[model samples]
Target: MEDAMQFAPSENPALATYSPEVRQQLFRFVLQLADTSLILGHRLSEWCGHGPILEQDLAMANIALDLLGETRSLYQYAAELEGQGRTEDDLAYLRSATEYRNPLLVEQPNGDFADTVVRQFLFDNFHYHFLKQLVNNADERLAAIAEKSLKEATYHLKWSSEWVIRLGDGTEESHRRVEKSIAELWRFSGELTIPTALEKELQTIGLIPEYADIQASMTAHAERVMEEASLVIPQQVFMLTGGKDGRHTEHLGYILTELQYMQRTYPGMTW
Candidate 1:
């Protein structure tokens, strides 16, 4: 695993024993997780009032809250690790689009019902497997957080998976729309498994899951679900990058404008 706190109070040694360099890397990795959740949560929240149905509308909103809950835990930990006075809100709202570490997929626009479903299905698949590995992290704090988040990820994946199958194999119009959504979103899917340079370093130190292992788990589940959905799988799609490196699509700017509106405008506005 990449970024494992292997030097536990028992296993190897305490994390404090690690070089300053490794601690810095761990901070970066945690930010990636936090930023990804924050952006995706905001994206899903957009469907809150626009959902095709009342029940599913609330379902999407609930899932958005789930992602935000995970984001809070991750950002709080990241802030502690960074030893900065920055709060979770600072990390979530104060960062610019160029500073965010979420993958490009999460920041993309939700075009329609099928578009939302495919985007979510792809992300939920990867998130479920990723959290499963994190649940075993030697850092009990992270592992506990991962365990709690896993329950949400489990339901998230199931819900998105069912939607994929429902729309993919349904009426002619529904099937066509879902297939189009899959095609549009498939290219960004590659980035979920492709690690950045920082991740490779973390993998070597056992601080995070191996990209190969995560990719294998992700692929197996995705193939099974897509097969059941009867959706055509895209092959040899050109992959896009840069989100993990803090480069993002323009869509993120618009998302941030709305997402940060209150905090950015009021500066330190609190509950």
Candidate 2:
């Protein structure tokens, strides 16, 4: 048997099975998850004190903290898997925009309260469903992380789902705003659910579930929430992708500019 659990040697101990190619794919897969969380967390952190209301301001901050916490665990695991002598901070702070594999949805600017809410809703639904299955996947290491993160993702989905309904059914203005936000963000929603080359390989090797594994459940939740919200998902529209392939939109550069500034400037500064 291919040493399923002993992914790496004692020095790293991330993944011990599969060929070098599979290991490489899994490394990228883990980084994709970590990068997605880190970027989304950063975007939410941007709204820290700028939310439309005090209660919502605190809520957004709390969600951002939760995502950042997940990001830390993922990056630490990625660092170990890479066996590259890199730390979590190094991986988080040192990467260029094109080097990141996060879907474009998270890197998008928080346009308005409605924009943030819609983005969180779409992703939170998918995150909850995906993590639920991920806990039983091939890799116990990543599954352990997924198990803990799923707890937080549960709250995240509830919060976002409630906000989706609240905003969509609240007032004419709120409903209109969220509708507009959905149009802008919906194109990016398919990227994560659609498999990438690496993601497909991981599925083929039984290392992870195919991205489609969560789509049905995720879509069902979205339909239910959207129905409750009096909103309709737009069909027949073109969806934008490519973030997982390291091709990204213009926004990622600006994000990295601010994100990498401290580390690039000081080279080794710590708070």
Candidate 3:
């Protein structure tokens, strides 16, 4: 299975036929996917030894690992598509906060446990459907990466869904906390499926799925989960933008400070 999942150069013949403009757009699309996972994974990893319970600590850590692994694979493929000499580390660690294409939702600080869970649930709901559509991407290598990542994403969705239900339907305090978290985080969710110019280009070329289709699927899934959890979906408000275009919130700067510290200090030092 590991060997079968290995990306071969021949898998993406479409790249050879594409114009340079199309190739650059595809590269940006891939980075958007990778950056989201990388930032979210780093956020989750901050909970390593701080989960409310031992089981949760381990679970969060494992999920973080899964996300980071996905980021590595996606970034590696993105680098290859760029056909430059940029390594995955360069893509992952060298970029400034203003250059990251992750949705603002993922880069937001993980507040309380409820806040973290709600954030994960919101993103996981969208991620599951997004990957489902991506599995059929016109780019075979992208599809292959999505196919593998989808398995982990399935587990992630289930885990987050169960937690959201557990918290939302639990005691009065738990319910209130998750509800509050939902309201606070809901604004960021809109950016997840709002198509950017690069994303639109990929959609036009059939290399990526339509944002509207993914948004519909995500909305249905989220509605069902929120219903089961006895939670209400907040009405849409003014949505925040610019994360996809490299403008991020102030929080991302601190995240980058911590995340890139070692790489920046040591340059290329590897164990």
Among all candidates shown, the one with the greatest TM-score:
3
In order, the Cα lDDT scores of the candidates are 0.86, 0.86, 0.88
Q: Report the lDDT tens digits of candidate 2 across residue range 73-92.
A: 77777877787899888888
Worst 10 residues of 2 by lDDT: 1-10
Please report how far candidate 1 places residue 221 from its true position, in Å.
Answer: 1.4
User: Ten consecutive residues with minimal summed lDDT in candidate 3?
Assistant: 1-10
Q: Which is the better candidate, 1 or 2, if ranked by TM-score? A: 2
Q: Give the alpha carbon lDDT tens digit for every residue of 128-151 in model 3.
A: 998999899878888888888899
lDDT pick, better of 1 and 3: 3
Q: Among these predicted structures, which one has the highest lDDT?
A: 3
TM-score of candidate 1 to 2 decimals: 0.93
Off by over 4 Å in 2: 1-14
| lDDT (10s digit) by residue, model 1, range 1-271 | 1222222224334456767888778878899999998889999999988999999999999899898888888887777667668876798889988889999999999899999999999999999998899888865666877888899999999999999999988999999999999999999988988999999998888878776888887888888888998987899899998999988989999999999999999998987
Q: What ranges in model 3 sit over 4 Å off?
A: 1-6
What is the RMSD, in Å, between candidate 2 and the native fold over all Cα?
4.5
lDDT of 2: 0.86
